[model samples]
Target: MTTPVEVRYFAAAAEAAGRGAEQVLLPAGTTVGGLLDLLAERHGPALRDVAARCALLVDGVLHRDRDAPVGAPTRVDVLPPFAGG
Candidate 1:
């Protein structure tokens, strides 16, 4: 089954994606890693590079495990590294 997810991009991530937010349809039980791959495919290498240095938040909570499953109707935030304190 396919599910809908909201992806919010921040900083360089937003620039790479060319938008601050978008909705995507993904297979049910797709992992965080899978989502990253899909995003890269859709947005190209710029986004892939930015995403590599980004921190992901799933449903408002930080998600570090790429293997973790991303459920339906979820919100994912991609935050790029910040230089200043």
Candidate 2:
């Protein structure tokens, strides 16, 4: 079964995705790693490139464990690299 996950993009990732947020469909219990691969495929090269350097937050916490299953009804926040001084 597939579930919907809300992906929120910020900064360059939003620019790449051409939107701040979107919904993605994934098999139940899919990992963050798997989600990234699927997302890269859906959005094409721009987002694919951003995925490499971006940080992923699932539900409000930084998700470093790509192996962990994505808990559905989830909000995934994507923050890409930024520079300011």
TM-score: which candidate is best?
1
Q: What is residue 16's positional error in candidate 2, in angstroms?
A: 0.9
TM-score of each: 0.89, 0.84
Q: After superposition, how far is residue 85 of candidate 2 from its true place, in Å?
A: 12
Best by lDDT: 1
Residue-level lDDT of model 1, residues 1-83, one tens digit each, is 88788899999999999999999998988887888889999999999998887778888877767888877647889888888
On the 0 to 100 scale, the lDDT of residue 27 in model 2 is 88
Q: What stretches of model 2 exceed 4 Å from their correct place?
A: none
RMSD of 1: 1.5
Candidate lDDT values, in order = 0.86, 0.81
| Alpha-carbon runs more than 4 Å astray in model 1 | none
Put down candidate 2 lDDT per residue, 5-61, tens digits, no spaces.
788999988888888899887788788788877888878899889887777888887
**Which 10-residue window of candidate 1 scores lowest in summed lDDT?**
64-73
